[model samples]
Target: MAKSEDFPGKPRNAPTWMSGVGRAPAELPEPNLRVSVKEMLAQQQVNEPAAKQAVADTKVENSQAKVSGKVLETQAPNGVIAEISTTNIRVSPFQPRLSFNETAIEDLANSIASVGLAKPITIRPIGDGIYELVGGERRWRAHKLLGRETITSYVREMDDALAQILALTDNEGQEALTEYERGKSYAKILDSGGERSIRALGRRLGVNHSIVSRCLLLMDLSNEVKAILDTNPGLIGGKRAKDFIEFSNEEPELLLQAVTAMRDEQWTQEHALRWLAKEIASRDQQKTPSKFTDKEISGIGKVRVDGKKVELRCEKTVDAKRLAEHFEAFLKTIDRSLIISE
Candidate 1:
């Protein structure tokens, strides 16, 4: 069963459909086989009236239809769980998952094929006969994978911000979700104004502040690196993302090269890190500057001397004739022979 604190701002009486939080699916009650003579008489007396009342109740329920458009609906505690057409159900734009594991989804499809869907997906009616998924996307995909036309869904009411929060919370800590993807979701939640700050967001999500802070560091990555993550999020782990971000700032070009190699050559993060280290070390070893001497002459600006060549940068107000005469006398004092042809 879901506790109110599980969803910080959720209504007290609302049904909890979020993954791993809600009450167990209700079970059908066993039928009473034995009948008493007096009980049978009493049941017969009320059956007619009960039938009439049920008809009236259904009319009211239909008037205030639980979900828009036509869907086979079953009532739950506070909402309706329906068998909705898979085509009409769309993934939420606020969904945090960037990629899905096909093999895992196939395994799920096989399991569902064997035992049926254990839990229905949660969604919200988005009008025009469309519904937006809130959780259980894997199940939805499995259903699609099986070519099932309709899927069991629990339809509820929630806005984009709440949907995002629920989506993030539902997928957090799952084995398939990469830390880079998690960090990206965190950035979206923060950008959406769902939380005022990282601490507040962590408190709301029941996540540790340090973990959240470390994850947020991935957002500082360059756009190119982020694009790489968009396709291959598992390239770097959350713990490594912090170190990677540092390297990206300190050695941007090298980081890009390493990440590009990871994408193209299918290099592991460990391999990429090792390659980056070797390249940086090799670069440092190969860097050696040419020997030259620079001196600032009092009123004649600066002079630079290399083995056989000397350059004089004259001051703004120095007379050209005076500068030439000064260099002529200065050249005569040199111990080595001067090349004066030019």
Candidate 2:
């Protein structure tokens, strides 16, 4: 029993086991932690006031250990800190963030390896020995990277909705999650029957209603556009995504072409807008008749050429077979293989 006296920066009121146990081993290759429950119990020399009482009152049942007068249970009262096995924790199904930055996770792992975890992850007991992550996935991942068997966690009692909200709030504050991801999170909650309306959902999550509405709007984007956004989350913002959705409604085929070009060509929003404008103008220009010629032929009723289309109104008495023969002969003069008929 090293007692709280041996651990530097130990909280005066904390039990001996909780104080110095937070530090990770100096070397990654070593399986030993700075302090292990078995090693601490081996000494049997508790000295601190709280540590003495905690050990005296300790109890064990169903493979659950009681230390500091607290039990790690699924129905335990909220706000308990415990050292738990990493293998027993499960990722939350409500995780809104789809992508994690590997470089950032690596940096975090290196930092934790150099200096022990500064903050404990938040989790809620879900079963006999299983816990579901509420927040701090990055920290959990870092602990995994260090090959640690256990992690320090702040345990809580929360329902699915609360757990999901906390997870979103945690990541939103820590990193730059794209607006699309944020919106997707909002949509999930709404779809889960958690909130009645965007306004209510925003109020519950403490986000602006407009922002929530914008995020939901992304759900309406074409699958093609959504696929692009999935891989490149920062491709277009909520406002721009709305623009795309609206443009797609007007000209889906043309918009898909432009969106594909936007991704491949690395186009700026302004460039894409300009390209769309030019293309629309060119199409409209083509529709306008730029050339027209009308003349009365001696044998034929009349001849007219409008842009690329030509029409002839044969006189009522004109021979239909003769006119067809003449037209076929005229087309042959232009190309020997030319033929007319359906």
Candidate 3:
């Protein structure tokens, strides 16, 4: 028999009956219940430390990603102060940005050098320690030309639309835009949520509505005409260019030819338009009948009838009696005719 102390909750003889004669009824081993619970808790503890370490590392990396650079300390370089020499820096190919006269740039450069940059350029970081110019490219250029290294600038984080506007403002203020440049800039403004009408853009730029409309038309000209204008900006004024727009698309080749002729021969706008008209007429002649015709009369002279009017033009050598007789016969055939002129 097992003693009560040997089996804490069982009767002394119960162990023996249940199992064999108890030599302490084969004691069951204690189940390892804490093992799984302790393991799960331990794993959670381990993950907590790892998560904390990861957060710390991420913060440190973020801090290290900030932008860093200093402005150049020297005066602007000479070439940089002048107009942008690259033709590829167009605002829009179809509608170029306006251009300012050289005289204006020179004046502004002199002012800037004397008094320092009145307005700072705006730039935004593009990555890899480089910054894309947002605005004040002209000022930046001038400073570079003045042998300057460090320039006064406004560093901005901007979206595409704002960046374009800043760039345009800077270009416009610095007198770096051409008429075409002005037109394109106006177009950008029109497209960028400010206003869509040419008149509105003209108002913003302080120009007439007609001028703005003309510039818009110029946006549609072929590259050839644009090239000529770009080469010699003063070749034609806004008014002439406006008139040229009327013919640019319909007669591109002829328009270009006229522009070339005008440039080479220094022809006036009137002469160029007239020459273009004549060329157009000649081309039309090839496709259709003659616009004017002459008819000969027997025993008389040739007369011209231009659809609306009939006249007899004779050389001095013609006989007056024969001409008079033919005229009388012609009038008789017509029955009743009015001759008011002598």
Candidate 4:
């Protein structure tokens, strides 16, 4: 067996898997990965001491108690890497991440094909010969690309709360996860029987408390807005998301308008924010009646609203027969708010 290695990066609870693996050998036409599973395992087993020494040499003084506890669980008391069938592992259902960059994953698959997996994914045994992933989904995915039957992993007993914490902390470290994704994770953690408060969640995420709060608001974003954000990530962040959400509250149509502008105009975050703010302002401006609004009635004269009531003024040239028609037209222009409030 090869010397065991840890996962390449931190943990995230996002969803991703390899697509090309399901293809038949004829589709590949030739070998993809350079080494056989047996050879790779042997190489890892042979390099164990060097890997451990490297870890020891790089180790720094650590005082964070929470980190220490989690770290202890990641590696067993004897510190040996274990292997199990890939069929036994199940993706975590509570994962907060919904999207993954396809290009990045493909590159990882290519790397694994050339050399082999550098790090083992973390998993906790659930039952019935199954395990749930705690971290290193991408690595698991790369292994899937190799079409291997077994995966190298750190196996341990973990509760839902600790699994969640490990997944969030690991994910937040590696990529620019959408604010919506991160927020959804925070909401899930909160939903996990109060294991983490907003402040505690923020501390774990290494973000401000307000940032955590803003991410939660993402859950309230209209589906249209979220779909747009999903395809165009840098298009919105927590702060910009708050702007779109505020506009949505004013009038749901206003949020839709922002989505349309963002899609059709290909707006930058600044452009979208500015447009939403201005549109909301314009709609707000048109809402309240000023001192008076005049609607001309052509032949009959004009109707004026002096805020409280409608006043009809007639010109000497107008006939009285058209009076009802003009009055009906003026009714459409009347403020419905006062009537509704009553």
Candidate 5:
């Protein structure tokens, strides 16, 4: 059965929202049928209890273009030098220089005051109307000292690897790098695959392939040797590090001895090279295999076989399982015909 209102033209079968039974549907909150997970997270983040609980949960912040390049570059774009507000620019966390020279920066500031900045610093936008420094920290400091509101900067969009390399190379071009800093930077570039190969890295660094190779060798120095050099920032150079690494590869113990000698005597590079030569000769004499037994050295263990006999002397401290595995590996390498099986 149907019922009609006797007032102004109204139907009893009118839609629920249109009916005057209660408030209109549009007045109530809409259903979240099409709400996304991100929206749910935002809602949770807004809620006090849910937000607090989320702190303990393992949360992964997945971002795609929030920290993008093309849009950031569009502000200044290629070959465009712009004057960005000083306060808006942030220092780069990836800057290679560990400590700034106060005296040198002061001198630079005085010069800049007299002649003005010769060049603009390089930077890249990192969203939110903020920019990150790519290079020229010294110049940035000078401008900051002068209480200038804004300084000239060249803006570019780059990835972490490219940003790091450019920051490193810019400083390198203007100033020298410590051996540790240079080697580590070179290693980072090589490992990051930013330049792809040694030759490519060399080209960017304005060095020959051999020089690039030697710089990387500095990283192979033992921790003990590095610790000694750390105490004196410029105690040794790249060439010396090359000789040290080669000597260490031949005799690791000799490296420790050489480090002690260098620190105690304050030996120059020439003196150090002479010491390395002597150490290498000494190691060669000791490591020469004897007729009675041949000694095999490895990371795991040192073995001496008694004239092709079953007698074996193992010196390295190793677990029983590891020793057994090493023995099995050695056995596998032997000619199969030499084995007698049932």
Candidate 6:
């Protein structure tokens, strides 16, 4: 038997599809007749055996596209002026919003001029001749500087979010990318996704959350400081890198100056930090008096007693006789007539 809610006014024998359609069946099968999962598996094995599958799916989805194009031309896109692509292919518009050191860029430009672009940049076509850079903007810039007519590129159609992720991953895979580049990539992940949480980004990238967070923090530092960090691998340990990030916002200029001094003057982290503290204190104008008084001996000597306990101190580097003469002169100034001991 079935309730009215279960079957409505239709017959219990009515087909499931007929229940919703115009026609109603006269009767329905008992619910107890449904097959169990174990029975289904047994029947399936008898009909067609299951096979093991590979752990990772290497095949790219068909909906995605990949194409090659020669470096037709390159142009400075947006405020990022420097290089051009060979072909005006349509690409995703998600530009990597980060800055690079002019010095580094110049080095890259020189390398490109000398060796040519070693790798092709990836891009996804948006529409028409306009293409969005997926990866290899740096390479593109280099090639543009070289005035190369044609270069290799991979073009695909990807969603905006996926394109950004792909760009980030692609950049990260390159061994040549500097620490600053890695930091910029992490920053891009935060900017693209509303969740600027480093932990979440690290989980997505299959890396430890702290690493991602530290890299992102590095990006907040000025380029001059970042350049120093890049040059001197030992300026900050893993622990200190995190500390630097915490201070980036509060004392960016000081941090930059300190980093510059550390690199230029070959100062240790402790020295740089001490100088920074002193500068900060001076800015507050909280000065203190000197601890030493004029009466204190300026040199080393022994103590003696006449009327009062007196100590002999010397300023010049001389023998005991010269020191004695200095003491006699001092006594004459005090009394003009006093027995002196040799």
Best by TM-score: 1
Worst 10 residues of 3 by lDDT: 73-82
Question: Regarding TM-score, does 2 or 3 come out ahead?
Answer: 2
Q: What lDDT, from 0 to 1, does candidate 3 have?
A: 0.58
TM-score of each: 0.65, 0.62, 0.51, 0.58, 0.52, 0.44
lDDT (10s digit) by residue, model 5, range 261-292: 77788877778778878868887889987656
Global fold similarity of model 6 (TM-score): 0.44
- The C-alpha stretches of model 1 lying farther than 4 A from their native spots are 1-65, 68-72, 173-175, 288-342
**What are the lDDT figures for the candidates, one per model?**
0.77, 0.74, 0.58, 0.68, 0.69, 0.57
Using lDDT as the measure, which candidate wins? 1
Sort the predicted structures by TM-score, highest score first. 1, 2, 4, 5, 3, 6
Instruction: Compute the lDDT of residue 305 as modeled in candidate 4.
Output: 90
On lDDT, the stronger of 2 and 5 is: 2
Q: Per-residue alpha-carbon lDDT of model 1 for 226-268, expressed as tens digits?
A: 8988888888885667778888888988999999999899988
Deviating ranges (above 4 Å) for candidate 4: 1-80, 222-235, 260-266, 281-342
What lDDT tens digits, residue by residue, belong to model 3 across residues 83-183? 12222121222223334455655666787889766665555545554555666545655665666655554444555755655565565544445566556
Ranking by lDDT: 1, 2, 5, 4, 3, 6
Compute the lDDT of residue 129 as modeled in candidate 6.
50
Candidate 3 to truth, TM: 0.51
Task: Please say which candidate is ahead in TM-score: 1 or 3.
Answer: 1
Q: Say what the RMSD of model 3 is.
A: 21.3
| Candidate 4 lDDT tens digits, 1-342 | 986555668555443334444544445467657874446546545666664455444422231111111111222432324576777789987666676777788888898788877767777777766778888787777778778777777676667888887787667656657777777778888987645588977887678899889888877877777776666644567556777677667767766776777677876767766877787789779996688888997766789998678887888887666876876898899999867754
Local lDDT at 309 for model 6: 54
